[model samples]
Target chain A: MMMEKLTVYADRMSQPSRAVLLFCRLNAIDFEEIKVDISKRQHLSSEFREVNPLQKVPAIVHGNFNLSESHAIIVYLNSAFPGIAEHWRAKINSAMDWHHSNLRQGTVSYVINTVLGPATGRPLNPNAAAEAEKVLISSLSNLEDIWLNGDGRFLLGGSQPSIADLSMVCELMQLEVLDEKDRSRILSPYKKVLQWIEDTRAATNPHFEEVHNILYRAKKKFEQQRSRVAETGTEPSNKIGGHSKM
Target chain B: MMMEKLTVYADRMSQPSRAVLLFCRLNAIDFEEIKVDISKRQHLSSEFREVNPLQKVPAIVHGNFNLSESHAIIVYLNSAFPGIAEHWRAKINSAMDWHHSNLRQGTVSYVINTVLGPATGRPLNPNAAAEAEKVLISSLSNLEDIWLNGDGRFLLGGSQPSIADLSMVCELMQLEVLDEKDRSRILSPYKKVLQWIEDTRAATNPHFEEVHNILYRAKKKFEQQRSRVAETGTEPSNKIGGHSKM
Candidate 1:
């Protein structure tokens, strides 16, 4: 039986979506990319709901099978495709599962509360930001002290990068939107985490950088907005401009 | 090479731990059970940290390999053990990944805020509980409308219960500690969700009840405590008694 072409519905601004996109490109898997602009609430539209009832981006359609959750999507692709079976292992699976509630939760919460919330016209929630920062610091500490403790540069000490590395590095990439001081203050304590992120990016290389271009654009736009606020000499409104087109 | 015996580190009071325990029992996988009582703060012990540096329950030791995260443990067990490969599938993987931020988060947050907080001498946060309730209601609606919409009794419409079913059902079981009024009010609108829970429970009976015996005991104790509070004419402390021994 011939396999149907795979379709990925994602938004690069969304971390997990970028992971899936980068993974496909890295593995040389042929697929179509359908951008779902979450900032515009496109993910909530009725049509997207048909693809994922949960109405989230980074969902996939292979033939009649539809699946959501980036970890699941990557795992399925690895299983369904060829030449990538070596990357899927028990340790990697453990790392991916740990990512959801730990690293992923912290980075997403911190970035959303501090940066994305105001950018989207939601008020900056100081209390929430403080709470999220604690989780972020603790999660980073775990990455430095535990996960990267092994001799291997990647998580669980594997010499080669795996799906876990891709997914997590994508998550940490959200910090790019933070101003230099805030980002450095939060990330500086974890030498290992910093090196691991660099190592993951180096491993994935061109595809990793290519998929993250959207975030880099957003980061640039965010910095420009901050400077404009500074120049106006008024009380900083804290809100940045809305999402840029991908 | 001879295979070494597996040791499961868990505490039944924890939802994911029970899921791991039930999966092992259901699959008839020979293993040793090592309880890590979270209520007593045993999971925070230095020794437990050696087993899982993240210091969470539902971890496993398979020979020299130590794995945490219930989803990972269940997946690993299914792959490593005999007679269980049929149960592992992409859809099930999707459901498990989705559970972390959806059903599992809502249930765990709501329970901790309203029931577990005061019981553990932590002050109640009505704001958090209210927020958690909204997420809980939304999650229940999703489970009913999307997951259980299919003809099959379990999630994603599978006839035989998968690890996703065990994990989610165990998470939902936390609501048993709530008073009847609150539990009914929260769960009533989702008819399909209610039925799915029953179907999952029935499909995994005997062992299900046996594993959940600790929760049943906790429920009875909670009810007795509520009656005492009512007789005393005190404002409902909103805290149930501390975790009962397994």
Candidate 2:
């Protein structure tokens, strides 16, 4: 069977894009990965909008058809590939649905308001990060108690990691940039969740680390800036992270 | 064939619960409809948490298995019943994913803060709503220009309605609680969207109208109160919407 050609527009900086990119690489799916450079605001350009009128990252163009939203793109891929386990179909669907407004919201929005917004040149919104902490704790507790309590090593108790796990673990992994005290305050309470993250990472291996390299670099730069500010008497300029247009 | 019994925990006031309940009622799915009244804060109670720890409505119990999230529950039903149309599987899934932080967020939060909060005596956050309108406008424009552009009456250009139709239209119908001028200002610009709502309502028929009766009455009482205030020139002291604890 001839597999349909797919062109993926993605950025490593975003959580969902990392999940979609890692999935393709882990499965050895043939495709072109075009870096959208969200920090550069490439997603707002007219050409990208032609492919995805919503102008969001992690969109895919297949033949004449175009689809946006990372979860949607992954679901489309599941059918196109025909190799995903039958048992995973319904459970994975449910997980993605739950992930959308829960883990995705709790993790991504929390970090964006707290660390990313301030670290980047964008103005940080007050109290959102504080509110987000409550949501994150509640969400991670559910992930540990409800989703992971099943017999399998991954969510839905499956022996292998589903796309849902990849999607969620990627969202949680963004906390790596935050200083240890803050990161642990949020993540350390959930015992099963930490184990699940490691298991998911080991399962995805080289591709997992490969896709996350850019994020790791971003964290290092953030740390260096914090240290530099400590050495200097003056505050870091407002334009410190101007590249993060998103 | 013998069928397993199912139980659905829901609240009529919440948009997604209406979607899930209507799907069951329309398809003749055998299930117990348990109304966890949000006004009473029944969903937050410990008993309900045993069913769905996250404490949100539109959860379900099938034997010992439990699941929350309206989108997840409906998708699970599509497979468990196997009576849903084949064409709906992919498109409906995609629509639900796109809906989470987009249409659902834009419509529900905007109304909650702008209209429902004030009417209900809940503290309304100004910026959250001001921000939500921007998102709502962007989402509606896409629904008009892209999703509704198809030949079919509903999203995905389908001849008959899908669960996605049930979910999204339920969200837009919440605007019925707002006054005519406000509602018209937000809704009137999108001709196709207005038509799509009517088409969806017609397709779903009596059940759609029947399910939305609570919202209808809420709107009527709101109008009556406004009229009373006009005649007497005093604010209504009674909190009419106290039951809508959400």
Candidate 3:
């Protein structure tokens, strides 16, 4: 009998997509990956809409079960692959689960809404990037405090990594890739966070080395795209001065 | 054995705080609520800051386990009380946990950035409000599509309510309390969402009704506070204006 296949629809640059990829790798789950070209508006296409109407990446199609949202996918996968040589269930404990759903969500939003938008030329205002930096810094300070006070190992109290680690590490990695300034700011003051990154990378599967490589390449692509936009002197779609009424 | 005293530190008008209150009511979790006065800037007070340096509401103290962030609180309560005689876990699974996180977060940001500031007599750039509205409308559309496609009972697959329902409902309620016009435009088109609200209210524990009443009272108080700010004609906090950056 053929192994049950998990088909992940993802864009390598999306932090959530990378989280899913890392989850599959860590669990030794057999899956095929199909890249969704977010840059080309592939997610907006009708064919992709059938799979996930939200047009978001990090969706998984497992036979009849179609799923989106990286958190749900990670939880479902952990539950499905209970015997995959990892203490999967323990990772979804009270604190870590909450962290994944709340603090992580807050930080990621701050990064995306503030940092990524401005860096990519889709900011609501020119000053939006600086505002995001302030919020991001404040949130990072809170995270650092949590690490100092909490178990201080993996995001949860574990010798091994879990979903919480996967969720957070991916977001942090995405922030790092946004620009050298962001990377330096995040890594400089948060020394423990830097160590956490090393730990998570070491824990992740070697297959995901390809996924990591893809992020670096995507960052380069994003820079090139930004420069092209600058050269053409054309504003991006979501900018405040563009079609935005506000 | 003393029943575990879960003390909630909250400001009822806040969306996240309401989520925690609703969850406790839905699950019959015994807890005490300590209202933090947002009107007097109590959240920013050093006393409150010790509990949560981020100074956000929806923080909880259950014995030695203190936590902030509404989503985290719900997940923690659900897990901590697994025998609560409900399909809570399944509710989290089907409620578009991942999608709801993004949608609810975005909606709250929009409401805070656009409506709340203006309602409180803080000068809002009309252009900024309009831009925030556009993003908010897009998120609401996605939510409407999800409801149109899903089980149509609760947010998840259950005939009963879940954490997702609480989170989304609180956000909608926040928008409603902030700007009646904006709420009508955003919520009126989705019939199923309206039905979901009715269903959730009917299914929730009577204790939650009390909490809802408290929130209503708090909303009125918040409105008064806004009126006072307008009357005084003082400049709003920079943090309040910083939301648009997100």
Best by DockQ: 1
Question: Lowest summed lDDT over 10 consecutive residues: which window, candidate 3 chain A?
Answer: A88-97
Fnat, one value per model: 0.77, 0.51, 0.19
- Could you give candidate 3's per-residue lDDT for residues A40-141 as a string of tens digits? 778999989888877889888887677887877777776676565554442243334455445565556556664455645564343554555665666566
TM-score of 2: 0.91
- Residue-by-residue lDDT tens digits, candidate 2, B1-246: 227779999999999999999998888888899999987779999999999877889899887778878887887786788576655765567677888989888888889887777776777688888878888888899899988878988897888888888899999999898877878988899998899999999988899999999999988987887789899986655554555334
TM-score per candidate, in order? 0.94, 0.91, 0.80
Clash list (residue pairs), candidate 1: none
By summed lDDT, the worst window of 10 consecutive residues in model 1 chain A runs over: A235-244
lDDT of 2 by residue, A24-143 (tens): 887777889999987678999999989887788888887777888888788777778756654466557777888887788778778888778876576776588877778788889889
* lDDT of candidate 1 at residue B1, scale 0 to 100: 9
Q: Report the poorest 10 consecutive residues by lDDT, candidate 1 chain B.
A: B237-246
Q: Residue B107: error of model 3 in Å?
A: 3.1
Error of 3 at A100 (Å): 7.5
Q: Local distance difference test, per candidate?
A: 0.86, 0.83, 0.67
Each prediction's DockQ against the real complex: 0.75, 0.57, 0.24
Off by over 4 Å in 1: A1-3, A233-246, B1-3, B233-246
All candidates: CA RMSD in angstroms?
3.9, 3.5, 5.9
lDDT of 3: 0.67
lDDT of 3 by residue, B1-246 (tens): 136678899987776788788777666678888889886689999988877665778788877776766766766676687666555552265354653455665665676667566555466666655666676677667666764346648764566666677777667665655545566777788777777777777777574566667657645765666677789975334334245433
